[model samples]
Target chain A: MNLPPLVQGFVLHFGEMGSRWGLNRTLGQMYALLYVSPQPLNADEITEKLGISRSNVSMGLRELQAWRLVRLEHHPGDRREYFSAPQDVWAIFRTLAEERQRREIEPTLSMLRDALLETVETDEEKHAQARMGEMQALMEQLTTWFTEMNRLSPETLTRLMAMGSRVAKLLELKDRLRTRSG
Target chain B: MNLPPLVQGFVLHFGEMGSRWGLNRTLGQMYALLYVSPQPLNADEITEKLGISRSNVSMGLRELQAWRLVRLEHHPGDRREYFSAPQDVWAIFRTLAEERQRREIEPTLSMLRDALLETVETDEEKHAQARMGEMQALMEQLTTWFTEMNRLSPETLTRLMAMGSRVAKLLELKDRLRTRSG
Candidate 1:
């Protein structure tokens, strides 16, 4: 891409990080370009700037749409589609968390659930089932927490995060007050 | 592996999920085997069970050790190294979080810092820097929060997650009380 040096650096970094992030390099670069761009871009423009084939851009965009990381836009009187990332950073973060939960965590939880239902005939099976039960419990707790947090406004979430470790102290105070009342 | 059906199911599932979790199939299976094993196992046992080559087992163990997901053990009168996963699931979760933050998040934060330092001569560069700044700020806030959470005992951390969205209401209550007092 003929992006400004500052933007290019960030795009390149994301491209490099793509594999670790479970995205291909081209897709990562594609998303980065969209994320920093001031306006929505069409496939032709994206292909020209990033210097990749039109087919690859189309494929990457499709993958990004599936991930809900990119949005499709249509300009007035134009048949060609355009793409852009969500403008709000918090929204983007929330989208990513939700997507990962759905795509990765949910499947694993389902597998664990199915595994837990099977009859155990040996000590090894018993131990394995117990471990699976623990994992399922933890995942359930996390998903519950995630669902609750998902309902929170971005402002509220930000406040919660800013509280940092101070949250533990608050929990302690609340517990002591409860004990005294009882 | 000639593992019991129950144990084998879990191991095979993890092996399939390896790519999505930033691990290879064999490493995923290797860790899964150790995690559910009744006792610490030597390399030969792992090879025999997983039916992978000895070299692959050795390489996978070293990688797991590097990730701190597997521990090395020594038995009296035996020269071969034995390995096992931590029995505590909470410990495993914490170790994974810390490793990811170190390996992935920290580097991105560093790169953002460097990019922010450069002078911008155009509108596009300025806009890009602004976006980078936003991302950097969010990352810093998250890292701070994560660091604080990392300090908590497992009991405390579990309690916090259990708190879920309830924490937001508590925050609101505290804020209202402060306003009234002021």
Candidate 2:
């Protein structure tokens, strides 16, 4: 850990937070270093700064790349690959959400869909299917909304969220007007 | 594993997803069994149904209770405790989100706040602080929005999400009207 105290604080925190967010401590530390680095960092630099084994850093970088949380970079005439995180915070958030949805939520949803389609021969099976149905419906609603939200520009999404509860009020007004007109 | 094929499939899926979602395989299996069970299950019943050891069931149940994902119940004249997941899918989702927010997100946000306040002595520290600031601002926006959304009725939330990108159009219309009036 050769980082300045200020930068080290964040790297350490993310290292602790990594498992909670589906990455290990080393991956978290590696990603944090890349995120805060002013320039893209190569494997050797990451290994030296974090004081981890070269193989560990190499494996962690590969894992980060798999998650799409870190990007590989190349400098002209440099043989070693460099890595950096997406600089835009919004882009990072979107990427994380999409990746999790793909990896975790989508599998569960597909499994539920298949389970829901199965024929039931007993009350237990019927009950299980019904519960799965409810879970599937909710997931479908959320995933549909997320896909739609992904189409919006980050600025638009931010503005919409900034409205907070006010958006509910807008929906209510629209509902009341539609009722009267109908 | 004494479950019917229909229910067992879902349980196995959740068990696999457990580690990804911050719970271990046993905890996921326990919760899924409870979630789909028609009646509250006692420890022995869960142990037998899942064919796991008594101690593992005890530990998994305790872990679920701590996560607030399972509720404890008692039947008249029975000394043994029973457990069941909330029947409402929306409630389960809300509880899961809130728990993860408190355990995972809140700490990171607090750490970022403190890190952002620290004095910087070098260009590297300054750049790191700037990155932290960006991350903090985005997190604050998201947490605020999520907190507000949590206050809404599930039906309202479903409707709001169903509105999807349409909400962006509503915001755009509001902006245009304000510009015209101004």
Candidate 3:
């Protein structure tokens, strides 16, 4: 692979981190390449730059598209499909969060709910159900919070995040005001 | 493996879901077993219940301890160490977040910082650096927010989460009040 040294370094590092992020090495490297490139890259360019097989690039692009991490574009008068990472980083982050919730968190929550519905035949079942209940409650709360936050415009979300835990001060103020009014 | 049916079902599900959470199947199953069991369990018990080899259970337990997901204890007269998941689900969630930040997020941020420090010889390098800067800024903001939240007592954290995006309304109110005061 004859990528620029900087891009090469990041691609390799991302590939290594891929498993931790629930992606395989090729997908990570492909995404990293697209992410850092100045222009949308076709599968042929990707294969040549990354020294990967055509089929592998095809597969990786497919998976990335499935995750909503990559977008397909067509160049003027060029029919070959090109892939590019989302231009906005926050949009990329939001896509990842949404996809992971749909693929992993939502299914796990559903499984817990199903388990909770089953009849308990013994003390062991009761204890297991209780554990599932705790986990389900935690998951529901987090998912609810994410769902609410996801509805906000990106600008609003950024402001809210920038506020950070300073929002706690607001909460404290609200509580004090309520106490005085009551 | 003679696990109770309900416990077994959850353990198997966790094992399947483990890779998505950056854990192997064995680690997920072992943690699941400990989480659902009413009492602390020793390695032998885990091995028998999960039908994994003794060595696999030992390795899994060692890794789980490293992740701070399991606590080790000793019985009054028994030499074998017993392991249990933290009783509070929030505590488990916190440990997982802290560990992931340390292992994955922090290192990625550091890598981005290092990349940003490099001299750019070409437009490609310059563009890549800009992208890296954007990502670094976003990550810094997120880590800062998490650090601030982590400082709050768990009780306060719970309250903030329970408040969810209602906090956004508070942000709006604060903005309105600031406009009047200014």
Candidate 4:
């Protein structure tokens, strides 16, 4: 399978980054192909482009769909299912963040909570609980911030992002006003 | 090597999540052991506790040090090096986030930028460039926000996190006040 030089570069790079992002090489390559393609691609086309087997393509598509990173579509006259990445890159980023928080962060938070609830029979257990408590507090704070960010309209989110360090200035201003009024 | 049941549960959970977070099972287990241990542990103690070979422990410790998730210390009169996780969980979280952004996100952003710089000879290439542009913009915005957050003092970061959704309210308040006065 011969990919265009540009697409090939992206596909290969993503393949290498797959494991780092909690995905396999094939899934990363498949998502990269879909992202770069001008049009929705069918399973056979993806397999042909990536030089993978038909079943592998099917599995990869399923995984991508589960992550909500790809969408299923069909052309007017086509009976086969086709996949393409969301056009809005921000949407894709949010989806990835939410999924990772759910998969990785949430579980650890729960584990910490459970550990904290256990009775401390010794100083060692007390120390362990203290560590878990600190971790839990940090995770909870982060998750709360994430949830609030998720509530913002996309426009507002974009503006907030563009604000960047300006938020710090705003925060300082708020503190000054509060101090003066109080 | 036998671990306390509670510690074992936490260790196994982290070991399972290790690959998802770009670390291996051994690295996760070693970190978990260090995290829960009441005191710093030497390589020999870690090997005996985790039932891993000394060399495997060495490699995992090296990787953990590279991630900045583990610290080395020496007890008085003890020549063998000792390893422990940072007592400050937030500091550990920040280190992991910074390291991951440096290793994974920055490379992908650079790749996108390079792809966008190429001359487009075909409609497909043009479309690919458009997609890459969107991704690049999103990544740049995110990196900018991360950098700003990183610049914040730990106290300020904690306050901002604790503020959570209230920041949005503050933004709205500022907007309304400006509209009335300006």
Candidate 5:
């Protein structure tokens, strides 16, 4: 409710980014404010800073919790709930990845598995089936990869980012091999 | 219009995934189906298969076309417009990176730049400005990184996917550093 213009702009920007991320305007702004603040924030602080209704902040907090983007906090002397994001960016990233996988990836995968069972009646159907099989396999492998990636030690992930410069040439070389020989 | 159950499931999953990727459900599904299929799809084919109105498919196709995810094809004697995804996974991925930068990142960056100009007087405003400055710098860099990443040839992009296994670890390690030191 009392955010500075700069912070307000930050909130407004995230509000816009929210729709792109399958969230709404206010949701985006609320999370942006939460994420950037150095200290943990309570609902009342959030409501006062954001100038939204108390109920809206409450609902938004619920959604953010579901996304694993926000963690609840308790102060020794205070009865009101406070929330914060993991200070470690990697932890936040992993939580987001896992949440998206659970909320989006796993269910779609199950549906694909079920669809794989439908009987085919025509050559077109069979061809479609074949193509579907390829994508389904791809999705399954991607899921497996995410599972492993999420479980990987933090040090290992850091090494991976450091290796980005090397990967460009390695992949380009592999592409040439597949193109020329295959 | 006919897709194998497995492909159907994955395509539908992608459709669902699409919203998360900044597309609506119908557009997501349409692109998913197109992405995995061997043949180009017509609007009517998409409408009939997805059980959406023809107009919706028409609009979705237009949006996909704008995103560069769909390309028009003229089959010698065929008058109807048909569309297909880029044949290579890397190409499709590149389109995604580039298109999203254009549609979402670039505009937001501009907005942030403008907001950065507003003069600050209070301590809270200064605090907000400091945070906004940090985020804006990181976002500008990220946008730059995506642009540079897209400029890499498809061969380079595929190789980068292989690098995915390493990125998680590197990012995690960075988080540790920031935690102990920052």
Candidate 6:
């Protein structure tokens, strides 16, 4: 494995983080390796670097590509595919959020909406429907919000994440306005 | 089982999303039941509601407590322990993000730091160290960003996620300014 000591350390760290963010430890580690790699890495190279089974590397790469965390690079005169992460951090952020919304949030929202179509037979059912409606609306709003953000430039995402302390006050005021308007 | 149809739907849906969000399917469904419930539920109650084994509820509730996702509640003269999720969406978000950070990110960072302290003995080791440093730095920054976000009100989170369209641009500008200033 061509693992660098310091870089390898970070790669290991990301691998662990992968599980927390809806990925496995190996997936996290693989992305870390790709993220810092200046050159596009083929699956064989990645398998060699991490010293894991080639099949495991293949599965991990598929997951990363699904997350839009890795890109395939086709080099001339070689049938082997090389991979790399987005150099622009903002693009990575957009793709991650977009993919998550599609994969995780959208299906659940659809299910929630389907539940809404059912007839209520009792007070308990009525109450459940009310709560479901609230959550469904919230999901719809959140989904639309992400869709909008997916369209943003990296600069916007950074500024927004660092919106600083005013964020709290802004939220309170926004809620108040939402209440009044409602 | 006081299973309302819509609530049951929510329970089943959450069960499916559980693995995607770190929790397993049963845990997800169990939490969904707790979230919509007006009163605290004992393990038997949860088991009944979801048609699962009482023992499974016991284990699932234990995991929820560890994640800080479920709260322990008691009633006077009640011997059985009760569990429920925070009804406030923001509180739930805080627990999820914070618990994940502690479990996944912190340990990996520690590992990377230790590896970075080692002396490089070969060209390969040197490259590893360089990669580790970059990853460590990225995790640190991302961690800082999440830490800051954790402090925001749920309304702020909703608003921020709603501001998805602007986040990328905000991030891009932040990166440019950072480059200019650095």
Fnat for each model: 0.75, 0.86, 0.67, 0.59, 0.35, 0.49
Give per-residue CA lDDT, model 6, range A1-182, as digits (tens): 45755666677767767777888888988998888776789999989989898999999889888888999989999999999987765566567768878888889889888988998887767766776777787778767875775665555444555665445555565567579999
Lowest summed-lDDT stretch of 10 residues in model 5 chain A? A158-167
The i-RMS of candidate 3 is 1.2
DockQ values for all predictions?
Answer: 0.80, 0.87, 0.74, 0.68, 0.29, 0.38
Q: Write the per-residue lDDT of candidate 3 for residues A92-170, one digit (tens) a residue.
A: 8889889989988988899899999999888877988999999999999889988877778878778877887787898
TM of chain B vs. native, candidate 4: 0.94
Write one digit per residue (lDDT tens) for candidate 2, span B1-182.
Answer: 99899999999999999999999999999999999999999999999999999999999999999998999999999999999999999999999999999999999999999999899989999999999999999999999999988999998999888888888877766777679999
CA lDDT, candidate 6, residue A52? 93
True lDDT of residue A162, candidate 6: 61
Q: Where's the lowest-lDDT run of ten residues in candidate 5 chain B? A: B154-163
Q: How far in Å is the alpha carbon of B32 misplaced in model 4?
A: 1.1
Ranking by lDDT: 2, 3, 1, 4, 6, 5
| Interface RMSD, model 4, angstroms | 1.5
lDDT, candidate 3, B1-182, per-residue tens = 67888888899999999988899999999999999999999999988888989999999999999999999999999999999999898888888889988987888898898998999799998898898899889889888988877778778877877887787888888888799999
DockQ of 6: 0.38
CAPRI grade, predicted model 6: acceptable
- For A69-108, candidate 4 gives per-residue lDDT tens digits of 9999888898999999998877898899999999989888
Give the clashing residue pairs of candidate 3, or none.
none
**Model 4: residues >4 Å from true position, as ranges?**
B177-182
Candidate 1: CAPRI quality band: medium
Model 6's alpha-carbon lDDT is 0.77
Give the higher-TM-score candidate: 1 or 5.
Answer: 1
- How much lDDT does candidate 2 score? 0.93
Tens-place lDDT digits, model 4, residues B45-140: 999988989999999999999999999999999999999998887788889999999998999998988888898788887888888888898889
